[model samples]
Target chain A: MYDALKNITFIIFDLDGVFYRENQSLEGTKEIIDYLNEENIEYCFFTNNSNYKIHRYKEKLLTCGIEVSEKNIFTTTKLIEHYLFENNLDNIYVLGSKQLQDTLYDKYTQNSINPNIVILGMENNITLKDISNTINLIDKDTQIIAANPDKLIPVKDGFELECGVLIDIIEEYTKKMVQVIGKPSPYGFDTILSKFDKQKSETLMIGDTFETDILGAKNANIYAGWINSGNKLPYNTLDFDFMSFKSLIELKEKIKEAKR
Target chain B: MYDALKNITFIIFDLDGVFYRENQSLEGTKEIIDYLNEENIEYCFFTNNSNYKIHRYKEKLLTCGIEVSEKNIFTTTKLIEHYLFENNLDNIYVLGSKQLQDTLYDKYTQNSINPNIVILGMENNITLKDISNTINLIDKDTQIIAANPDKLIPVKDGFELECGVLIDIIEEYTKKMVQVIGKPSPYGFDTILSKFDKQKSETLMIGDTFETDILGAKNANIYAGWINSGNKLPYNTLDFDFMSFKSLIELKEKIKEAKR
Candidate 1:
């Protein structure tokens, strides 16, 4: 099918509710992955959910019937880790799930007071105790950082509560806003672009929503294939032209048609 | 001096270049407003914005300084004008100034296709003749309406062109976005709220900068302030809480003392 998807070298996939919601598969996701693998249509798994480590994300995707290595997945958690490692941060205070805490342990030095930064994620174990430790570090003039500021994440019923709400509540108390590194932010895109040398126009960013996917593409000036499967219109109108598709199978056919 | 200020019963002011920038505003604004004038403050103004005919936004303070108009002096050009007056609004094409034209004139009924809503204001006025005849009722439509985008207001270095630019340019092309009423959109807080028991605490708001003093107030919120003088920051953090005094004089000595 990618035979007609000529010149197209990179395919980006959104994790969580888009490709697979939590532990379940959303139908033909495997077929699309298989097609990409067979066609050498370089693809990367991208997720804004920073609750898990890269391997964990890989494991979750595999459970959903796809396979990828730690290197093949890009999470905002890793992006902040990259920034931290290159800058040599020490004694970080975390605000996230167990998987996120483990990710930092895989990369850095031991914890200490008056360290470098405060990193936040979805802390399933969130407690007043956790908030106290985080705020204490922040009060000591430590830089506060986050995986992203996206307030909500999709759930089966609807959007499950996510990170930004936590960020807002904590920020109001600490009087410090977290530095974010995810979608709509420059950091996440930087991670993607650095991994591939393919032309942007030849690379199609197919995502569900316009505010994040379409707006991000317009800001970066890339070929946008808006997957308007959500049946939504933007509050403010958008400027770039986009092609909407129902499914990956249909998208493959459309690409084949475009190539001809 | 507040002893004298105590006699000043009502106040109304503008919003744009007043409490915020053309788009953004100062930080710590809401924090201050919420702190003071939570009560007893009645009558606030938001005069210079809306280009809309006043209605629905009785509660959308997230964007601008104030959201209350217990007789707010601001106007809504978009809301339907209440009157034993005129109605006939159809076939009116809005060229530009969405803030005003679409928000304000979107609801006028015209006699024919002679362009009822000409919609004009502070804009670059890029294309006029393109739809002027249709709007001005030149060949078809009846009445004309303009959005309150802007003409070109004075700012820092030179003239900051606004909807008027579009109005001027379009007149040559489509003949202006449509001109109904410019400033003092229908719900002028000054005009409507002026006849009341207005106080500072009851109607206080915060904004980042100043463009339009939307209303008169015992309290206003913004980033900039001058005392018949130049822009000045009295201290490092903030001087007063909710009250936005463009001039130290506008704010009473007792208020200043209270702030300290």
Candidate 2:
């Protein structure tokens, strides 16, 4: 698996369509993962989808026949938790799943007296009730932070809800803006870059989303490839360079050939 | 009620904190509504909270001891609907309330062939699935539209969600910004003025939200009032030349006085 990317220290792969499109693995995903695994090359799954907590993805990837451990996974959920924990924020009202609440349990419980911070995540059960609570808290000068600004998520049964929707609800309620922390955001990418041993020039960022993956990598001055697995293309005037690949495997083969 | 205001042909009130502050009624609310009812005056409720459809607010207000007919409502919802309908845009995927959907329903239902426009509101029910559908349709070239872009909603139950959140989510999904329709938007205010017989003068706009209401009135060259609500004492920084009033009874008493 000595690929054209042999010189790179890390390869950040977007989860939804980049690694696996919906249910079926993207063409050549297994081989590439196997190759990366065989070489012991470290890569991070960089996604803006903060709906599910960190560990759920590793198991799902295993089901997709691409083996990976929870330790290897990197989601916005973990990123913001780190941000809050390091900043000494104890109170958090999560606009996301219970898994996220569990992830921040005890340490980041909702503060009744003096709230410290707010974390935005995916909430399957988001109601006007949550919106009310969030708006109230934010109005009370509580700091609001978002795991990711991604408004949509690609799910196995078509696209389900994601964190940004709840973020929208809360943002509108309080008329206050929140900070974003995941992929496409410099926060997650900076984390990957800091952890990565290679320079940005030699690495490749493979993502199916042009906004997050393609543009996000370019924002880091990295080589970005937009895999058009969903067969959708951007129509706006974007000022970034990107490679359009039909699938991840095709790009993999190109990488291998370049190495040879 | 007659102490301050006793002169005016038009009655404009802020939607949220000044009027009813959501499901709960604020102080002096019933007296103000009753005073307006007792007098033959024309008044409109203005809001920047683009959360529910305007009619939903009508329903919400009816339940909250305010006797506001749908005709007395002037919102970004109706403003945007008029814009879309005027441009012959009927088929729409609104990100707002059922009121917004209902507003465009007639125009779209009449066409009943292919939806042409999308009206995004401050939707708490926003889902990633809904975003996906919105993106897919936008990819197919449906014109994107929104009511207003006020980011926060100050509710009586505390602060509520606003419209910018929905715009943020949809922007990530579609990668396309929408045509905004409400206050702080000159176009939205212009649409409202056109609806009424106001010539930017001889008319006054009323609202509690200074960001959208006062600022938007200034942009539209319309007179406005900052609803002090017996709270917000010492009201400062108005975007337009505005009168400050505590209640609608005062407004009616003044309007009658102005006519005399």
Please give the RMSD to the true structure for each candidate, in Å. 16.5, 6.8
Q: Give the residue spans of candidate 1 off by over 4 A.
A: A1-6, A22-24, A110-112, A124-133, A139-141, A154-159, A169-177, A231-233, B1-260
CAPRI quality level assigned to candidate 1 from its DockQ score: incorrect
How high is the DockQ of candidate 2?
A: 0.26
| Candidate 1 lDDT score relative to the true structure | 0.52
Clashes of each: 129, 20
lDDT, candidate 1, B1-260, per-residue tens: 23333343333334443344445654433543443355233334344444444443344445645555433544534222421024544444544446555453445543334443444344333222222232334433433444343443445533344444344434543432344343323323323433454433333332323222221121232112222223333344233333345532344343435444
TM-score of model 1's chain A, to 2 decimals? 0.81
Instruction: Score candidate 2 by TM-score against the native.
Output: 0.63
| Candidate 2 residue lDDT tens string, A71-125 | 6678887787778866777766676777777777656677644567777777656
**Which 10-residue span in candidate 2 chain B carries the lowest summed lDDT?**
B1-10
